[model samples]
Structure formats: C-alpha cells, structure tokens
Target: MAAEVKLAVRGAGKRYGEMDALKDCSLDVAPNSIVSIVGPSGCGKTTLLWSMSGLHGLTSGEVLLDGRRITGPHPDIGLVFQEANLLPWRNLMDNILFPFEVKHQKPDHGWIAHLLERVGLTGFEKNFPNELSGGMQQRASIVRALSLRPSVLLMDEPFGALDAFTREEMNQLVEEIWMETHTTIVFITHSIEEALFLSDKVVVLTPRPGRVLNTYEVPFERPRTMEIMAGKEVYDLTYRIKADIYGQSRMQARAAE
Candidate 1:
C-alpha cells in the first residue's frame, strides 16, 4: 500500500454561473483502492472527477493527491474520458505516446509497448482508430492513459458507450489492470452492478448541487468475478444503490416542480 490516503476531496464545490454542480462534497480514497461514484444524471459525478484531475477549476475546497494540494493537473494522475478521443490520424502507438509529446518529453517506447500488450493491443499498434472496434479503441485509449504511469486513474464512464458484453469485458479488464498495478482508481458510473462488482467503496450522490448521499463498502472479497456478482450479497448491494439513485431522482423532480 502507498499510504492510507491517496486522494482526498474536502468541501469540493464547482459552479457554472448560477448552477451549482457540486457542493460540500468530501471523500477520501485510500491508496491502491478502487472507489466508484454513482448517482442520478446531472449529479456532478463527472465534475468531481474533473476537479480531482484538475481539469476543471474548483469553486471552493481542495483536492489533494498524496497529501499535496492539487492546484493544477499533475503528471501522475491519468484520466479516461467517456469517449475514446483517439485521433483518427494517429496510429495506436503514436496515440499512446501523445502525452509525452505534449509534455515535450521523450517517448518511452518500452513502456508504450508494455501498455499496448497489457491492454491487448499488441498486434494493432500500427492500426488507426477507425480500423479498430469500439471496444478496441477504448482499450487503446486506456493504454494511452496508463502509458504515463499514473499513480491515480480517474475514469468517467469509460465503458458506457460499449455494448453490454463489451462493457462487462472492459470492467474485467479494468479490474485486471488495477490488480496488476495496484493503482488508485476513482471511477464514475451509472451502473449499480458495475459499481458493486468493481469497487471497494461506492459513493452515492444526490442530483444537481450534488452531495454525498452515502458510501457503501462492498463486503465481497477481492479479485471479484461474475460468479461473485451473482451472489446474494452483491445483488443486495446493487439493489440498495439502485433504490438510492431512484429515490434521488424522484426528489429532484419534486424539487424542480
């Protein structure tokens, strides 16, 4: 374990004009643990990820990485957006090396190759984004993010666009990567099953002007699988989270009315 606290969000808030996307949200991610955020739409889950990555400025509070305040993006944090966002003109290897290029650092071919292999993109290194399947493209994108050797990985619905089978496979892939690297991960998702399957803790949020509704610790043992997910304990946790999100959505509707 790296330390007790890998990332900490304290009173974190973000606003767009009159709209408060997040408010008074606080959470601590233990080192090398997998944490997932789940909530109704417009609940600022993505904003929280952006704030943690320093991609968006915070209106108040602070995001700390390994006890240091993150005033701006740090090289040790990697983000995987919903879209693969791969450049059509670039080959897989080139795309994975893009981060080093932007930072004006020399490309680490060895690490890039290793990441490609890890993501199962070893044979497609010279292929363009258009030549790959949706799942493969996302795999490449993940490898690109990991190429920087980030200690913390921030994922915002990275598997949302894929088909159900593909999404499930990607979920397993993420778990495999986490187990292999012991990297701290904060994933945002709308799927209760996915969150329950992969997370050590699932943080539930309310609708806009989001606040932490609850945090559920997954009692299942590590190295989770589809079999574990079929267990009653896992199903119960998923049902509970689903109910929380449903209730929050209803509350938002009433408040708007």
Candidate 2:
C-alpha cells in the first residue's frame, strides 16, 4: 500500500580526469514524485544526471532503480536533454518513434498519438523539426521521451534553452503530464523559480565537485497555478533557496583564497 522507492543514488561520485564532478552525492526518488536538482552553473548537475541514466560510469558508489543496479543505459529510463535533438530528416512521428525503431520494436501507435495530442503536436506529425518553432520542437522531444512510458524520467535542463514564456508553458505542461502518468521524475535546472514551481522536492548542490547542500520540500498544493507563485510562502521559500546557493558559492570562494 505504500509508495515504492523508484530510484536511488548511494554515495555516488563522478570524476573526469583530474576534475571531480560530484562527491558523496546521495538521493532517493519515490515513485510518482518529482525531484528537481538546482545549483549554479558548472556545479556538476548534468554529471549527476548522466550517472543516474548510466550514460557515465561513476567513480564510486551506485545508482539503483527498483532495487537493481543500473549498470548501463536501461530501457525503462527516459532522458530529455537541453537540446530537442530531433533528427532533422525525420518527421515528428518518426522522430518520436525513433527509439522504438532503434530497438527493432514496434511502437504503440495509440499511445504515441495520445502523447502527441497531450504535448499539442497533434497534426504536426508529418512536419520536420526545422519546420517547427523551438518550443514546438522541444514539446515533440518531451513526447518522444514519454511515449516509451519510462518508469523514471530524467530531464537535464529540458526547457533551459527556450524563451521565458515558452519555458513557463513547458513547465506547466510537465506538471500536467506528471499528474496524468504518475511517472517519477528527476529534473535538473539552474532556475530557482522553475525548481520551486515543478518540484515536490528540490535538492540544492554546491559548486565544482557538487555535493548536496540541502533538500527543500515544496509545500505548494498541486494542480499548481501561476498565481500560486505570487504568494508570500512561495517567495519566502525561493528566497531561502537563493540564499543557500549563493552562500555556498561564497564559502567555496573563501576556501580557494
């Protein structure tokens, strides 16, 4: 009857050559919950995501999904990166189905169609990536990630490249999709507002060799509205997180000098 522990990182660490990207990082994600990772630029947020997705091997510790070790890129996990990364030659439908094609499997047309509609790309199936706006293309990429019904969705700055309005729209769309599907999500971003708006739990990280500085629970009720962000509670929490992140930067600078 209890919610399951969907994904976990235990004593996880990553390094590239002489540079340590993450150190002693650990977190747990519950099924059907959304967790956001936030930090300043170059804080190893992407490295953490790569480790979770098994795209990069960790220097220490482990990433577990459903009690099993994630040794490599598992099929049950879906990832959406900063760029839409759609195939220029393939139309929307084909691009969305590209994952299935690569695995020599047939895609579920019914579900694919439904996802297209959910992401507002219903009639644009035949259109190429170049033919669509940046926001539309990103939506298609998101739908593609979700079309596979991944048990865990890993998004690394998926909307970071979009304009302000588009980013906010996509944030709402993400919330809608998460509510509908109940899929576990680990979203990484640099924006405090984005983290506060979309996360059930926001994990703050330190700079360079990133470490968990704090984890804040977002108490805002869902089916969240834009107006909710204007409340005193929301502003206070955002300010707190902003202070924690900036404070860490100052500490790091002091240690360096």
Residue pairs that clash (backbone atoms under 3 angstroms), model 1: none
How many residue pairs clash in each candidate at the backbone level?
A: 0, 0
TM-scores, each model vs. reference: 0.96, 0.96
Q: Alpha carbon lDDT of residue 191, candidate 2?
A: 88
Backbone clash total, candidate 2:
0
lDDT of 1 by residue, 1-257 (tens): 54489999999989999999999999999999999999998899999999999987899999999899998899999999997999999998889889998999888789878778887888898899999999999999999898888999999999899999999899989989988899999999988888888899999998889889999999787788668889888878888988898987787689889
Find the candidate with the highest lDDT and give its number.
2
Candidate 1's C-alpha runs over 4 A off are 1-3, 255-257
The C-alpha local distance difference test score for the whole of candidate 1 amounts to 0.91
Tens-place lDDT per residue, model 2, 1-257, is 96678999999888888999999999888888999999989999999999999998999999999999999999999999887989999999999989999989889999999998998999999999999999999999999998889989999999888999999999999999998998999999988999989999999988878889899989788888868988888898998999998998888789899
